[model samples]
Target: MELTDLLAALVAADSVNPSLVPGGAGETEVAGVIDGWAREAGLESERLEETPGRPSVLVRARGTGGGRTLLLCGHIDTVNVEGMTDPHTPRIEGERLYGRGAYDMKGGVAAALIAARDASRLGLAGDVVVAAVADEEHASLGVQEALRNVSADAAVVTEPTELELAVAHKGFVWSEIEVTGRSAHGSRPHLGIDAILKMGAVLKELEQLDRSLADRTHPLLGRASVHASQIEGGVELSSYPAQCTLGLERRTLPGEAGPEIEAEIESLLERCRQADSEFQASHRTLLVREPFEIGQEQELVGLVAEAAAEVLPEPPKITGASYWADSAFIAAAGIPTVLFGPGGEGAHAVEEWVSLADTEAVARTLVALAARICA
Candidate 1:
């Protein structure tokens, strides 16, 4: 299938991640289409059911040489489209293709599939493995399974990058900090302690911790960053809240690990503990995504650069990813992987879209990339 049509079809399928689904974050509605495509291609494909509702698709083709293999990985599921104006319908306006997952990764999946398709057509030197993974927007299970079971020389993860080769990227530490206090009636304010007040004290310390990491920088990922993504506390205004919770996202550079960042966050909570004996805080470390550092000099990076040169008259930007993707899992699995795909800065933004011209070019680049990697 042509990349544009494939992307449009994929987008129209409504694969809103299970997390965002009403039942649970377990099933993807779009898995069947990808599986059908794999089966039709005569590839050895299977579904890895991580849980009852969540399943990931894996497909592999035969290679000629005993040479190393190349892996093409992409996520099959997408983020929730609940509040979207017209969730299931994908539209092409001007030079852009607008849809829910069009930019974030369905486009990447198409490019990767096309690359492997062309590779099989031309008969490359080594095998090309393609994985249309699931839960990438929520969990890393799809790529994680592929990394554990599949062996490959290198991997190319198709994530939106405006055709740049992402060599380095930051990992993240997700944590929730909760504070507890006594509840009292609004009329008797002195009888109850306010969790909201406790949060204010914690907030000041968090700001200090955030500022401290500001100057810390890596060559590609310039600096460490932090954000309080969400917060929730009391429901009633008349009662003193017993608890308040803050959802935090900390961006980590090459030197940091998830556990260590969690510990650092723990220390901040400790400081809050010191301020008042009643300022009790609990911590839940959600997920620790590790940072990736791949230079353009690496063989995989070189292959992508050459492929970009082949597809476009202007050179593709070679840089690191600021946002996390399946690349982290590929790197964690010991495969050197870099991200290359269609679209630009509008990823995950309002009315996200992928450029038609860029999509075609990315498809051709993937074809060239597979040829180079296989050889």
Candidate 2:
């Protein structure tokens, strides 16, 4: 099948991540579509579903042996299409393919599949594995499961990078702060403690910390940052609330230790306590994902750059992505990984689309890369 057609079929599948949107269709149907294509291409394929109803397809073009294995990974699930019109119906105008997931990822998955199939004809000496995984729009359980079943010498996370070679991207940490106070009637000022007011102090501290982070900037990824995501408190407007909780996300840079960030938060909380002896609050770190970076001297980086040079008008730009990606997980697993994929606009937005020309170019670049690294 043509690359455009395969991508259109992928877009046509309702693979919205259920974790992100209640009752949203999961990756099973999309995985089935990819499995069919892999089998038709004469490649070895397997479906993995460590978690029920969420499936990931692993496809391999086996090589002659004795060379490094290369893994090409892309997610099959997409964010919700709440406002999109006919999001599952793919349309093409000029050089662009329009649909949900067409830009965010299904385009990259299509490119990886076609590249693996084309590269198999080269009779390479090493394996080429294509992992079409699930839940990247939310928890990223699919890539985690794929890592458990397969190991590779190197990996390429085909995320939307506008055809750039992304060697670094920020990671994130989620945390919450809960302030405690005694509840009382609105008329009794002496009997009640205001937890909401205490939380305001904490918010101010968080704002100061966020501003301080701007001073410590990464060359490609820019500044490490933090922002409030959600907050809740108070049962009624007339009563003094007993508790107030604030949820926040911290975008981290390379070498910024999670423990250090936790300590910094503790210090800020301590300052709030010093200001008010009655200030009582607790801090907890809910989740942490380390930032990903690779040195320019890495062999995989050079090989990919060379392959891209062969396929494009100019050498591909080496840069970093502001958002987090599965490349961090792959890199954390001890396999050197980089982000490379087709370019487009409106990822996770009302209208999404991918450049057909760039999608085809990405596939050709991947095939060229496989020949250099796998052979």
Candidate 3:
């Protein structure tokens, strides 16, 4: 099948992450489709299902031996298509292929598959692995599973980057702050300690911290920051709220540690306690994905950039992404990793589409990269 057609087939499959949306179709169907295609293409393939009903597919173009293995990774699951019109039905308008996940990922997945097929014909000395991962939109379970079984010298996360080579991207940490207080009738102020009011102080401290973070910036990714995601406190109008909780997400930069962020939050809470003897608050880090940055001097970076220059009309931009990706996991596993993929728009939006021209260009570039790195 043609690359565009393969992408259309992938987009047509409903692979909404169940973790993001309740009862959503997981990566099973999409994984099956990819596995079937891999088998038909005569590529070695395997299905990874660490979590039931949420499977990932790994397709490999085997090499003769004695060279570094290169992994091309793309996620299979997509965000919900709540507001899209005929989202599962792929359509083409000029150079654009329109459908849910068309731009965000399926385009990249297709590019990797076709690139592996084409690159294998070169009979390179190294293997090319295509990882169609699952739940990247949520927890990145698929990539985590892939890493447990697959080892590679280097990896390219085929996330949509407009063909730019992304060497750095922000990571994130989720945390929750809970404040405790005494509940009493709303009519009696003296008898009640207002947890909500106490939470106000914590919010102020967080805001100040966020502002201070703006002063500390990364050259490629810019400043680290924090924002409140969800909050809940009051119960009923007639009662004083006994507890308040704030959920926040902190965007982290390279070299920032999750433990350090937790400590910082604890210090802020301590400050609140110092201000008011009754400021009883505690915080816990819920989740953390460390930031990813590969040095420009890495051989993989040079090879990918060279391939892009040859395949693209203009030299590709070397930059960073503002969003977190599965690249963090790949990098954490000790594999030098970077992000490169097709150009498009409307990722997780109502009108999602991938640039067909750019998709093909990305495939060509990946083929060229395999030749260089896997030689």
Better of 1 and 3 by lDDT: 3
- Model 2, poorest ten-residue lDDT window? 256-265
Cα-based lDDT for every prediction: 0.79, 0.93, 0.93
- The collision pairs in model 3 are none
Count of clashing residue pairs in every prediction: 3, 0, 0
Q: The CA-based lDDT of model 3 is what?
A: 0.93
In model 1, what lDDT does residue 159 have? 83
* Prediction 3 TM-score vs. true: 0.99
Candidate 1 residues lying further than 4 Å off, grouped into runs, are 23-29, 82-86, 184-192, 234-240, 344-346
Worst 10 residues of 3 by lDDT: 313-322
Model 1 misses residue 191 by how many Å? 5.2
- RMSD to the true structure for each prediction, in A, is 2.7, 0.8, 0.8
Off by over 4 Å in 2: none
Tens-place lDDT digits, model 3, residues 1-375: 879889999999999999999999999888989999999998999999989999999999999999889999999999999988899999999999999999989999999999999988999999999999999998898999999989999899989999999999998999999999889999998999889999999999999999999998999999999999999998899888899999999999999989999998999899999999988988889999999999999999999999999998877899999889999999999999999998899998999999999999999999999999899
- Model 2, 42-123: lDDT tens digits are 9999999999989999999999998888999999999999999999999999999999999999999999999999989999
Q: Please list all clashing residue pairs in model 1, or write none if there are none.
A: 18-25, 19-25, 26-53
